[model samples]
Each structure stands twice: as C-alpha cells, then as structure tokens.
Target chain A: MEILIYLTQQFINGIQLGAVYALIALGYTMVYGVLRMINFAHGDIFMLGAFISYYGITKFNLPFPILILSTSLLTAVIAILIEKIAYKPLRNAPKISLLITAVGVSLFLEYTLSLNAFFTPNYIGFPRPFEIRSYDIGMFSINNIHLIIFSVTIISLALLYLLIYKSKYGIAMRAASHDLEITRLMGIRTDNIISFTFGIGGALAGIGGLLYSMAYPQINVFMGIMPGIKSFIAAVLGGIGIIHGAVLGGFIIGISEVFVSAFLSSTYRDGVIFIILFIFLLFRPNGIFGKNIEKV
Target chain B: MRFFLELRKLIFLALFIYLIIKLVIFSGLPTDYMIQITLYSFIIVLSSLGLNVIYGFTGQFSLGHAAFYGIGAYTSAYLSKVLEIESYYGLIPVIFLAGIFTAFIAYIIGGPILRLKDDFLAIATLGFGILVRVILDNSDRISEVLGGSRGFVGINKITNLELSFFITVFFIIITKNLIDSRFGLFWRAIKNDELAASSIGVNTFIAKLIAFIYGCFLAGIAGGLYAHLYTFLHPSNFDILKSIDFLIIVIIGGMGSISGTIIAGLFWVFFIEGLRIILPSEILEYRWVLIPIILILIMMIRPYGLMVKKEGY
Candidate 1:
C-alpha cells in the first residue's frame, strides 16, 4: 500500500516534470520546423533563463510570478537577437556550418554564466517562490506548486494549439514551413513569422526553466545541457513540429525514465533512452506523428 | 615529379628521426614541458585528423569518438599496469590489439547509429559517452585498476616528445596516404551528396562505417600514448568535453585538411599552456570560459576554418 502511494506520487512528479520538458522541446521543434537545423544553444538559453529568474527573485526581490513573466519575455528577445546575429547570415550554408555556430553560441552562454558573480562558478541552490507543501491523499500526493505548474502548462498548451491551428497567422506560418521561398514570393513576410515563432518558443522555455528551478532548486551553469538534449530527444521522439507530440514525447520520456530508474538502476536511465532512440529510428524514421516525404 | 615527392618524404622522415633522437640524447634545455606539450598536441592532431575523415570529409556528426578514445586509453593503461609491459618491446601487439578492439566497438555503434541524422546522432553519441563514463565510474573491480573516480594513480610513463613527434608524423603520413586513395574520394562524394553518391553505386553506409572505425582506431592510438604520457588514467579525463576539444581542433584547423589539424592542434596546445602562464592559480576555475567565446567567434568569422582552399577543394 505504501509502495502504491509512493509510485503514484512519483508518477505525478513525472507528469509535472514532463510539462517542463514539453516547454523546452517546443523551442527545439519550432526552430527545426522552420530552418531544419537543431539549435544546440536552446539548452544553454534555458539555463540562462533560469539564472535570470534566480537573479530577479533574489537580487531584485521580485515576486515569483512577476519574475517568471519578465524573464520569459527577456529570453524571447535574447533568442531573437541570437538568431539574427549568429544564425541568420549562414542560412544558406551547409547544415554543418549552422550547427557549429549553435555550438559556438552554446559555449559562449556557458562562459557568460560562469563569469556572473551571482551565479558563481559552482552549483548553488535556487529560490522556490511558493511556500506550498505536498498534499497527500489516500493513495496519491502532489505539491500545490506542482498543481500550479500543471494548470499553467495545460492552459498555455491549449492556447498554443488554438493559435497554431485556428488563426490566420498560423496558416501563414505553416505555409512558410512548407516552402519559405514560395511563401516569401507570395508576399508573406516570413522573417516576422520566424521571429514570432522564436519569441513564443523562447518564452515557453524560459517559463519552463523558472518552474524547473522552483522544483529542483539547484542551479548550475551547465545544468541545461543534459535536460536540453533530453528535451530535444522528446521533440524527436514525438515527431518534430507536432506541438502536442512534444508534450506526448515529454511525458513518455519522463514516465519511462522514472520506471526504468526505479525498476532497473538509475545509472542506466540514459543508456535505455539512447537505445530506444536508436530502435525508434530504425523502425520509424519520420518519428511517431511526423509526415514522410517522398523523394523524387 | 612523383620521384621528387618520394625523395622529399624520405628527407623529411630522416630529419624528423634525427631531430627526435638528438633531443632525447642531448640538448638538455628543459624538455619536460616541451615533451608534454608536443605529445598532447601530437595526439590531438592524430585524433583530429581521423575525426576529419568522419566529420569533416564524410559529413557525419559523431560525438562519441572520445568513448573509443577512453576505451583504448583504459585498455592500454590496463595492459601496461597489469602486465607491467614497456613500450620499448612487446607493447606493439598490445597497442594494435587495443586499437582493433576500439575499432570493433566503433563499428558496432556506427552500423545502426550512423543512420540518425544531425541532432539524433549527436545525442546518441553523447549518451554513449556518458555510458562509458558511468561504467568506468561505478565498476569496483576495474575501478581499483582503472581508478574509478579516484583515477589510475601510478602507471609506467614512457611517452616523450621524441616518440610522440615521430609517431604523430607517422600517423600524418598514413592519414595523408589514406585520404588520397579511392576510399577518400568515395567519402568526399558522400559528403557532397549522399543521394547522388548512392545512385552512383557508392556504398555510403560502409564508407561511413569505415571512417568511423578508422577514426576510432586512431583515437585509440592517441589514447594509448595519452595514458602513458599523463601516467594517471581516469574516466574523468576522457569525457564529452574532451570529445568537443578534439572537434574544436579539427574545425579550427580546417577539417579534411591534414596540415590544418597539425597547425590547430599545436595552436590549441600553446594557447592553453600560455594561459597557464598568464593567469594566476586562484582564478583557474574561470579559465575554460575563453575556449567557448573563442569557439563562437571563430564559427562566425570563418566557419570553413583557417585552411586555405586548395585546387582540389
């Protein structure tokens, strides 16, 4: 009975954790959807966002909600600037060129974070905003903070779904994704759409980072790399460019990691994920919900 | 003309051998630091050149080459430590065996894993790297010999600048010859256009596998030398960041260009060593910060890298 309750609690935390991954995965999916290039720096940007939130809450004494909102907006602007300065010029280059730039940017961000005094050179605990503790039922338990994160994530994803599918701007964005050159020729301002996509993705990732710090509370300069790559795995696992698929992949990854770590050994968690990735690529190259392209 | 080229090669070989032996024999002008720098730079060049075959020329992004490096390093280190062998005599078989073993492992992963494109391959390889580290970290049996987290404490150190320089030169010759062959052209074609190459009856999968295996073999060779050079082998030294360090050397030096790897590898060596002199010991934690910033700037300014384009390119 105690085991059952513990499993249930772990499951809830896993779902809430998946929500955070889904947010970060959206950034990877968005950039990939448009440019077909994996922005390796997205993980570093997520890390940077957490540091920003940490500063806002501690140094500036800002409230949790206010800090998260401002940090998300700031991250959006910074992401857009990174795209323009580093990635935009080499859009026509081979994919490798752009990848190298992404690595460069990722490295640069880590260095900057290391230099900051507040962040220091080592790992430090982050500030959790709410005083909310866990609420346990007969066979399940969850923190009020976790519930808040879950609600915000669900509502945000719902709005995102509506915006992407129902709105005219969404149509334009899809058109651009299909054929950027043709879309530009047809008088659609593709750059604006690209910027907007980055903005939305960055804001989501920033919020995810903030929520993550609130949960884990231990922030370091290099904390984003592993999670960033994992979320990118989530994006790939769910089929890239499928927004809801990102959420689905995130949950699958989260739950499977918990089960694997619990059942097997915690050390084998990543090995199992990579093995699944290899197996999945063999069977379904286009991913779960991804459309296949017929080459002429 | 080809005869003249062969003659030039012979002359270079003779001079290199003479220089190394003379340094080892006399000219006692503090060769300790020089030996370390030269050996490390040589190892960097060797591995980076090999990686260029897979990444630069073949257009595959593999982040797990360092796993093979660690595998080889640990293997050679184990043999030397356990068997108490020296590099002077029977270590030849051990080095060759270790390299082949590393190649086999690389081949196994490259078969199925190379099918992944871009980020997928990157993540998978990164995972493999971590797996290597984890296994090395947790195993108590091998940990005593491999030093687990504490690292291999004492090993016979026979690596010197003379041996390193000669071995590196030998590797450069081998690589240059290999890259000039039919296999090299096939790899270059795959890099240019996989679809077209496949249409033309080029077996890209085999070619990629070959590149991966060969790259891993050279990484093993470097690792074998590195284990002895440092005299303290550990899992922590051969991490993902070390993989990135090799990648940076190749990229900075013009990937697919042999001279480029040599030059950039040397530069990387000198650059880090120079930093040690300039910076105080207290602020060494922040020293790694410069690497990333420099990497970014270089990517922006010269993505193709510092190599001059030859007529062949």
Candidate 2:
C-alpha cells in the first residue's frame, strides 16, 4: 500500500512536470510547423517570461490573472519582433544559416538579460503569487500549485486546440505549413501567419515558464536552456511539426525523467533521457508520429 | 628542376616557420600572456579547422565537437597523471594516443549519428554532447582523481609555445594535403548533394564517417594541447557554449577555406581577449552581449561566410 501510494505520488508529480514541458513544446512545434526551423530562442523567451512575471509581481504587485496575461502578451510581442529582425531577413537563406541565426538570437537574449542592470546572472527566488495548501485524498497528497498547473494547462490546451482547429487564422496557419507559396498566392499573408505562429508559440512558452518557476520556485537567466532543450527534444520525439506529438512526447520525457531521478540516482537523470532519445531515434528517426519524406 | 620550380614555396614555408618561432619562443613580449594567447590561438585554429572539415567540407552540422575535445583532454590528463610523465617529450605520444582514442569513440558514435540528416543530425550530436558532459560531471564516482564537478586539478603545464606551434602547423599542412586529395573531392561532392554523390558511387556514408572521425581527431588533439596549456580540466570548459564558439569560428572563417580558418581563428581569439583588455572590468560582461549581435548581423549580411565567395573556395 505504501509502495502504491509512493508510485502514485511520483506519477502525479510527473504529470505536473509534463504539463510544463507540453506548454514549451507547443512553441517549438508550432514554429517548426510554419517556419520549418527550430526557434532556438524560444527557450530564452520562456526565461524572459519567467523574469517578466517576477517583476510584474514584485514591482507592480499585480494580481495573478493580470500578471499572467500581461507577461504572455509582452513575451509574444517580443517574439514577433525577434522574428521580424533576426529571422525574416534570412528566410530565403540556407536552413543551416537560419539555425545559426536562431542560436545567435538565443545567446543575445540570455546574455542581454544576464547584464547586472537587468537580471543578474545569479539565481533569484521566484515569488509565488499565492499561498500554497495541500490536500490528501486516499493516501495521496496534492498541493494547490499542482492543481493550478493542471487546470491551467488543460484550459490553455483546449483554447489552443480551438485556435488551431476552428479559427480562420488557424486555417491559414495550416495552409501556410502545408504550402507557403500556394497559401501566399491564395491572398493569405504568409508572413503574418508566420509571425502569428511565433506569437502563439511564445505565449505558450511564457505560460510554461510561469508554471515551471512556480513549481521549482527558482528563476535564473540560464534556466531556460535545459528545459528549452528538453522541450525541443519533446517536440522532436512527438514529430517535429505535429501538435499532438509534442504533448505525447512531453509526457513521455517528463515521466521518464521523474521516474529515473526517483528510482535511480539523480545524476543519471539527464543521461538516461538522452540515452532514450538516442535509442528511440535509432529505431524511428522521424519520431513516433513523424512521417518520413524522401529528399531527392 | 622540380626543386628549383618550387623554390619560392619552400622559401615561403621557411619564412612562416621562422615567424612562428620568433613570435612564440624568442619574442620579449610584455608578458607570458601574449605567448599564451598565441599558443591558444593555434589550438583554436586546429580545432576549428577540424570543424571546417565536418561542417565546411562534408556539410555535417555537429554541435558536439567540444565533447570529443573534452574526451581527449580527460584521457590525456588521466594517462599522464597515472604514468607520472613529467617531460614534454613523454607527453607527445600520449597526446597522439588521446587523439586516436577520440577518433575511435567518434567512429563508434558516428556510424548511427551520421545517418541522420540536417537538424536531426544536429540534435543527435547535441544529445551525445550533453550525455558526455553528464558522464564527466559524475566521473569521480568511477575514480576520485577524475574530479567530476569540482574540477580535475594537478595537471602538468607542459604545452609550450614551440610544441603547440609545431603541432598546429603540422596538422594544418596535413589537413591541406588531405583537402587536395581524392577524399577532398568526395567530401565536396557529399557536401554539395549527398544523394547525387551516392548516385555517383561516392559512398557518402563512409565519406561522412571519415570526415566526422577525422574532425573529431583534430578536436581531440587540440583538447590534449589545451589540457597541458592550462594545467586544469573542468566540465564547463567543454560545454555546449565552447562547441558554439568553434562553430562561430568555422562560420566566420569561411567553411572550407583553410587560410580563412587560420585568420578567423586568430581574429576570434584576439577579438574576445582584446575586448577583455579594452573594456573595463565593470562592463566585461557586455562583450557576450555584443558578440551575439555581431553574429546575427554577420549572418544577415554574409550568410555564406565573411571570407568565402558565393561560388565557394
């Protein structure tokens, strides 16, 4: 019974972690769907989101809902600007060039934020918006933060699904991903669609950043790198351009990471996750849901 | 007749050697700092040159070059410490052995990873790089002297200006010769188009594997030199940022141009170190901020690279 409770607790913890990964992975997948390029800066955007919310709370003393909304919007705008300045010029260049530029953008965000005037390089304790409370149900204990994270993720995913599947902009986005030139010829502004994709992706990562910091209660300039890379792996694992795949990949990665750290030594946690990626890639190079396209 | 015809080339080579010897060994520089920087520049050039072979020539994008470098450093450091080799002559063979060992490891990992294309290849190599770092972080569990995270100290600083200079020059010449050979043709073909290269019986996979291994071998050699140069080894020294630094050097230097690699390698080292001297300590961190902006601007202005023409060298 004790073992069962412990396992259940760990599973719940995994799901909470998975929720954050899914949020971040959404940004990577959505951007890749349209741009066909990995936005390496997305992770840094997530970090920015965390820092923004930190200031929003500590400085402005805004309530939770407004704080979340403002941070997400601001991050989305920053991301759109980033796409315009850093990415748009290189649209016709080689894919490798785009990748390098993305890396440059990432470094720019990280170091610029690291300046002492901005957020110092040192780790800062994240300010929680509300008091934490825990409840027990049948040998399981759950915290308020966990519940909030779960509800927020579900609500956001539902809204995202509606935005992508039902809205006209979403239709244009799908069209753009399918064939950008054709979509452009059909009178849809492909550039705006691409920018919108980056915006929405940035907003999701912002929410992810908030939830992640709340869970861990620590914020640092370099915090986004690990989670960002892991979420990217999640996006890849689910199939680079697939939406559902990102969510599935997130759960798998999050659960596996949690379980490994819990059962094995925590030191092997990162190593095991990478090993899983390697072995999985060896078997299914395109990822679980990724379709193989032949290059002529 | 052949000697007479190549007399100018021989003379230029002699002059180059003389310049390096003078700059590295005999120069009464303001400090040992200048000499160290020169030697470090050679090490960076050698490693970045290796990256030029993989990404520049063969068109494989690896984000894990530093992992192989760390491997070489750790391997050499451990071997030398265990053997108690105090002399520079004794360390030379160990350095080669380290490079060979790194190549052997690359050969093992390259078989599966080289099969991946573009972004997938990048991520896989990145995964391998991170995995290596994790292993290094916990290496002391395997052996305390390995010094997992605190850092591997007590290393002998035997890498002199002359040793680094000669090794770098030798490898540059060797790399040049390799580029001029038939394998260079294979590498160029593979880089241009793998499908077409394979159609023409280029054995693209084997060619890529060879480039990957050889590139990693160079990185290993550079790492061995680096271990002895600083007399310390830390996991952070071989992290992803260091790998990106090599990438930046390769891109700025022009992917396939050897001379460009050398010039850009020197420029990159000097640029950062020069910034340290120019910028006040209070604003030293701004250099990192400035560098990325320059990188983005460079990519925007000259996507193919600063030194290379559109048709490639």
DockQ of each: 0.45, 0.68
lDDT digits (tens) for residues B35-94 of candidate 1: 577568778787787787778878788777788888888888788777888764555567
TM-score of 1: 0.93
Best by lDDT: 2
lDDT of 1 by residue, A113-222 (tens): 67655465689888777787987776576788888889878877887788888998788877777778998999988888888788878888888888888878899988
Model 1 sits at an interface RMSD, in angstroms, of: 3.1
Q: Would you list the C-alpha lDDT of every candidate in the order shown?
A: 0.78, 0.89
Models 1 onward score TM values of 0.93, 0.97
Q: What is the lDDT of residue B196 in candidate 1?
A: 98
Report per-prediction Cα RMSD to one decimal: 2.6, 1.9
DockQ, model 1, C-alpha based: 0.45
